[model samples]
Target: MKPSLHAKIHLWIMALIILVGLGLIAQGGYMQAKAHFAQFLIERAFEQTLVDNQPHKPWSWADTHPVAKMRLLQHNAQGGQQPLGQDLYVLAGASGRNLAFGPSLMLAGAGVGEQGNMIIAGHRDSHFMRLQYVNVGDMIELYSATGQLQVYQITATQVVHETATEVLDQTESSKLTLITCYPFDQLAGNAEYRYIVEATPLV
Candidate 1:
C-alpha cells in the first residue's frame, strides 16, 4: 500500500525540523571554537608583554617596561569600603571595551614615571563588568608588576555614545579611565552607549 499525501507531508516536515536543529548545533559549536581560539591569542600576547623589573625611584612613570597583568580595584573614596578587581591590559590606541585588536596593545602608554593619562579598557562581560557598580568618589588602584602602584579616585561617571572620543583624550595628569558597555542588563544588540569611569591620581 502507498502512503497517503498527508503522511508524506508529515514525514517531510519532520525531516526539515531535524535538519534545522542540526544546523543550529553546528553553528553554535563553530562559534564556541572561534571564541576559544581568540582567548588563547589574547593570553599569549599578554604573557609576552609582561614586565618583571621595578623602577629605581618612586613617584615616577618614565620606565617603559611592560607588565603581564595589572590588578585594578574599585573602592569607595571615603576609605571604608571594599574594591572590585579588574583585569589589566597593556596596549596602544585601545579604547572602549573591545579587546580583539591583538597583543602588545596599549590603551595609552607604558612607563614608570610620567604625568599622563594611562587609559585602560576592558570587556564589560569578563574583565570589567563590575564597573557598573562603581560610583562617584570611588577609589581605583592600579598595581603593576614592577611593584609600582598607582591610585586614582573616581571623580566622574558618564554614559556616552560609543563613538564619543572625549573619554579617550590625553590628560595632563596621570589619570585612569575605565570603559564598559552601558545598560548592563540589555541582552540584544550593542548598548549604543558606553559607561565611563574617570579617576584622578590620588595625591
Candidate 2:
C-alpha cells in the first residue's frame, strides 16, 4: 500500500525527533560515566601520593598529580565526640581539569604546612561538597609528603564574590583556606560567588 505524502513526512519527522532524543541521552550518559572515571583516577593518584610520600600522577600521561592528603573531623555539638570524614586528595593546581577530579592547592600561595596562607579549592559538587556540613571548631588535617601532619581548626566561613582576594592574603602565621562555589545546591555554568572556609593552626 502506498502511503500519502503527508503521512510519510509525518513519520519521518517523528523518527528524526526520536533519533535526536536518543543521541542526547547517550551523550549525557557518556559524560556522567567519564566524570565518575576521572574521579576514580584522581582518588587512585591521591592514594599513590600517600603511599610514595610524594607527588603521584593518576596516569603516565596525566599532567596533574596529588600533592597532599586532607582529612576532616566534625565534632558533636557538645564538642566531646569527633567524627572523622573521608580523606581527599589535594592536587597541585586549580585548573579546570584538576578540579573536575579532585581538590587543588593554589600554587601561587604557600604550600600546605608552610608559614603563610595556604589556599585550596575544590568543586562544590564533589570534593568540597561536604564543606557545607563543616562547622566552626571543626578540625582539618593536612599531611605533606614529608609525613608532617598539620592540624587546623575551623574558625569561620564567609560568603564573598568570586573576585575577592582577601581570603588569600599572606600571613606570618600558618593558615588553611578552603574555597568552593557558593549556594552549594545551585548548579550553574558560571558561579559568581564563593564560600570560603578559614582555619587556623591548632595549638
Candidate 3:
C-alpha cells in the first residue's frame, strides 16, 4: 500500500529541520576551535620576541607584531606577599585586526615609558578580562623591545564615554592607560562606553 501524501510531507519537513540544526552546531564548534588556535600562535610569538628582543609575528602571513611583554603583579592570597602569575605579550598598534589576538599598543600615543600618555587596548573577554580585578597600588611590569623594563602602579579606574579622547591627552609625567569596552558581559552591537585603568610610573 502507498503511504499517504500528508505522511510523506511530514517526514520531509523533519529531515530538513534536523539538517539545519546540525549545520548550526558544526559552524559554532569550528569558530571556537579557530579562535583558540589563533591565541596559541599569538602567545608563541610573544615568547619568541622576549628571547630575541625583536618584533615577532604570530604567523608568516600576519601583519601584527608583538611589541612588549606585560605582567600583573598581585600579592599572594596566602601567607606570602610575593606576586604570582605569568607575563602577557602585547602587540603593536591597537587596530581591530591586531586586538583580536591580544592587547595592543596604540600608535597615536607616546612610546611606552615615555613622558606622555601611552595607551593600550584589549578585548574585554580575553586579554583584558583580568583588568577589572586590578587594584590600586598593584604593580604592572612592562618589558619593551628596546630592552627597557619599567614598573607602573595602578592609580585609578574609571568609566568614560566611547568618544572621550581626554584619556589619551598628553601628560608631563609618564602615564599608562589600559582601555576596554564597557559592560564586559554585554552582547550589544555597539559599546557605548569604555573601562579605563590609569597607572603611573612607580618612583
**For residues 25-136, what per-residue lDDT tens digits would candidate 3 score against the true structure?**
9998997898788877877787777687777889999988877778888656674334434567788899998887778999899776578999999888877878877777
Model 3 clashing residue pairs (backbone)? none
Task: Report the CA-based lDDT of candidate 3 relative to the real structure.
Answer: 0.83
TM-score, structure 3 vs. true: 0.81
Give the alpha carbon lDDT tens digit for every residue of 6-114 in model 1.
Answer: 9999999999999999999999899778756654554454444444243221113322223434444545556675746534444334443235321222435434345
For model 1, the superposed segments whose C-alpha errors exceed 4 Å read: 1-11, 22-26, 29-41, 51-90, 95-98, 101-114, 123-128, 137-139, 143-147, 162-164, 186-192
Q: Evaluate all candidate structures by whole-model CA lDDT and list the values in order.
A: 0.60, 0.85, 0.83
Best by lDDT: 2
Worst 10 residues of 3 by lDDT: 79-88
Return the TM-score for candidate 2, rounded to 2 decimals: 0.81
The alpha-carbon deviation from the true structure for residue 127 of candidate 1, after best TM-score superposition, in angstroms, is 4.0
Q: Candidate 2's residue-wise lDDT over 1-203, tens digit each?
A: 89999999999999999999999999999989987787678777766666767777787887888788789889887856364556787888889978887899999889876789899999888779899998898998888865678888999998999888888888888889999998899978699999999999987
Stretches off by above 4 angstroms in model 2 are 1-19, 76-85
